[model samples]
Target: MTEPPRTVQSYIDQTPAWPDGTPTDFIPMTAMQWRIWLLAPAGKFFEGLVVFMTGVALPLIVKDFGLSPAEKGIVSAAPLAGIMVGALALGGLADIYGRHRMFVIEMVVFALFLTGLTWSPTYLWLVVYLFGVGLALGCDYPTAHLVISESIASKDRGKLVLSAFAFQAIGALVRTVVGFLILANLPRSGRGAGYMPPRSCRPSCWSWAGSRSATAGIG
Candidate 1:
């Protein structure tokens, strides 16, 4: 007697051919694609550098401006206050607009204002510059976080975010180097004496050999 016919489902279950021979397509990523991922952090590194310098130079800045310590505190507070307001305002905009576009705009605005800080002629001008810095600071933090979540793969998201933070470290390093260089070269006075030295000795050696010397005056 003939065996009963095998059903389609039975054939499917029995067949290893289709499973083994299935065709699929996945485009391999290029080196350029990988590099593109780093561009964001590179942008962030510059931002970090600016923020770092501002902090490192604060004491010297207070002296330069002849500000009372309390006034110095207020000047320092300005950026934080601006950042908070910026976060409230720009964060909302970033959420409403696309993060990428908003981030670009924020970065350009920040860079411009940060340059202004270098040339600000008065305390008011400096505060004005920092207001823009606050706005940029607010937008960048959330925007970078959002970009990492959206751009990287699920397993890699944590690493990308860490990479962005790593740039902050890099920025801090850059600012430290810059502050030291400036102090080594610039003139300053303290403790009832002027401290100006030749530009030959390194920061470590100079600090020890001291005459107050250009003590971290970048602000």
Candidate 2:
């Protein structure tokens, strides 16, 4: 027969309980606990999805608007600028107001900026929109990191952080594929318009449809 395990209360009672506790390095979790850990960072799903969509649509925006490379760089940099500001500003506020509240605020701001992006008329307007997006992204990055870290057990921290970060890579790949698809479909009505004979490339067809809808303004 297997021996029964001693209760922790009994064990603690027997030991020397230091008034100023000696901090230990080790933490432990069971196999089942470890398995449950796999789901703890699922909040990243929403964050990852948003990031993937933004990255995917960026190239399409450049193509549709016929922006110069400098403009593309500037537009792309706007979000980055927002990120820097958001990290410095929102990060501290998030720490003060709590993670959940900041998360909600961040997501709302992201949605607003994304909607704005769809309607942006001028390059400057798009850049301004992207600036907000960057700020939201900055707020989310640390907030999500901290949330996943604090929620998971010490033993599972490594796995949780790694899993959350790994989602970034997945998001990037998804964005890349979507970008290629969008570009492939959009009308190639640029300087090279006559070079490639248009035989209804997939992206071009979608772009044509999109243009017609834009002209019609069908909500």
Candidate 3:
């Protein structure tokens, strides 16, 4: 009888050794793997949070900073620029050193820079700190994926990696809900009362949002 046509997957399955000649072994899921999977997604969550929170905080930032259209544009684009730099620079470093080391280091840097957003003294400072946060976030993208993929078994790898990335959507949803709630509680005039000055409402809201966003990654 003629043999059936071999598919790509069949070829892969039939192969008993890696290209380097190491024996292929099935890796079992373990508690450590589960932790890495969850932690990797948390990085994506923070990335989404930082990206969306800027939109939520923009109007307030503009109002408080009295930013001209040009300045506003720079503020909005700063994080993206930082991401580009980090991806090009730090991503390569992760490849050379190791994924897990970069993963932990990047998250710590991300948390510190992200939390600093709340205390920015000026528009320039805010832009600088936001850029720093984005740099750390950019580093996370590759490192997190690499760590998760390497830690998990081949059979379940695709599902787990995609599942981890799903947290980005969750982060966006959370930012939207939180932004809505904060706006809902504010006065119709957009000014806060009590201890906070009418003009201080925007910064206060931004601070609260920044703190919450930082928490997601830090934990």
Candidate 1 vs candidate 3: the TM-score winner is 3
What lDDT does each candidate get?
0.60, 0.59, 0.77
The candidate scoring highest on TM-score is: 3
Mark the regions of model 1 whose C-alpha exceeds 4 Å error after superposition.
1-33, 42-44, 188-219
Any runs in candidate 3 off by more than 4 Å, and if so which? 1-28, 190-197, 200-203
Itemize residue pairs with steric clashes in candidate 1.
Answer: 195-213
Better of 2 and 3 by TM-score: 3
TM-score per candidate, in order? 0.68, 0.62, 0.80
The per-prediction CA RMSD against the true structure, in angstroms, equals 11.6, 10.2, 7.7
Clashes by residue pair, model 3 = none
Q: Put down candidate 3 lDDT per residue, 1-219, tens digits, no spaces.
A: 999997654543443667998877754566887888878777778767788888887876786678999998888888888788888788877887788788789989988998888778798999998899889888777788878777766677789888887888888888898877766665555343322224645446777778887776677
lDDT of 1 by residue, 5-28 (tens): 976434323323346686434223
How many residue pairs clash (N, CA or C atoms closer than 3 angstroms) in each of the candidate models, in the order given? Answer: 1, 6, 0
**Model 2 Cα displacement at 209 (Å)?**
14
The lDDT, on a scale of 0 to 1, for candidate 2 is 0.59
lDDT tens digits, residue span 1-219, model 2: 998997643442333334688655544444754544444333344334444455555555565567899987787678768878887777776688997787667767776675665567677877887687677777777787776665556555676688777755664564466555555655555686522324444333323323332232222
